[model samples]
Target: TWSTDGVINEYCEPCEAIVEGELVEVPPLEEREEFSLDGVTYEAFNTSGGLGTLAETLKGKVRTLNYRTIRYPGHAAIMKALLNDLGLRHRRDVLKDIFESALPATLQ
Candidate 1:
């Protein structure tokens, strides 16, 4: 998603590089009014697969059903800024080129 959406310019040996570091605790969420247009609107958090699975089952039974994407809150904003504000969407090709050049495919 990051690559396709232009949020990330590349993919590296994620499982290896990331797993090498010790797990770090993220600090608590601080309320920020700037993060929202309406307080009710939220980035879909922990709802990605739920929506996919429930979609058909609740199709005609419900008029309004919404599922949020599984995200770590601030992730959406960072992504939105990367994809929308940074104009990466328009420069996906160059972004991909840079990413592919940097990231390793696999290790033996």
Candidate 2:
């Protein structure tokens, strides 16, 4: 969705480097966020936010099913970039700060 919408430009520099294969070392950062867990690092590129197109394709085909952990637009890419740039696996608060400062709030 984001790619089609040209949202990649909104992604942070670190994420762009990772996607371009310019980042090699990933380490821990001084600040961390709640979602981040110690002893673990994350790297991602265009990870699905949820079932995505599958949800529409499977509409009405099944029942009693649920899915979670759909990453917000550009969130995963930025996160991976942050992890690699900051040398930390998880920096939940820092990530939050970065996004909050960079992105405008949306009512939707």
Best by lDDT: 1
Q: Model 2, range 1-108, lDDT digits (tens) per residue?
A: 123222322232222112122322222221222233465443333222233355445445644222322333455545556656774335455656665677776665
TM-score of every candidate relative to the true structure:
0.35, 0.30
Give me the displacement of residue 107 in model 1, in angstroms.
10
Pairs that collide, model 1: 44-68, 44-69, 46-70
- Output the lDDT of residue 32, model 1: 22
Q: How accurate is candidate 2 locally (lDDT)?
A: 0.37
* Candidate 1 lDDT over residue span 4-102, tens digit each: 322242211011111123221111111122234445444442212233345456555555444334343566566446446876546767656655687
Worst 10 residues of 1 by lDDT: 11-20
After aligning candidate 1 to the native by TM-score, how far in Å is the CA of 51 from where it should be? 4.7
After the best TM-score superposition of candidate 2, give how far the Cα of residue 24 lies from its true spot, in angstroms.
24
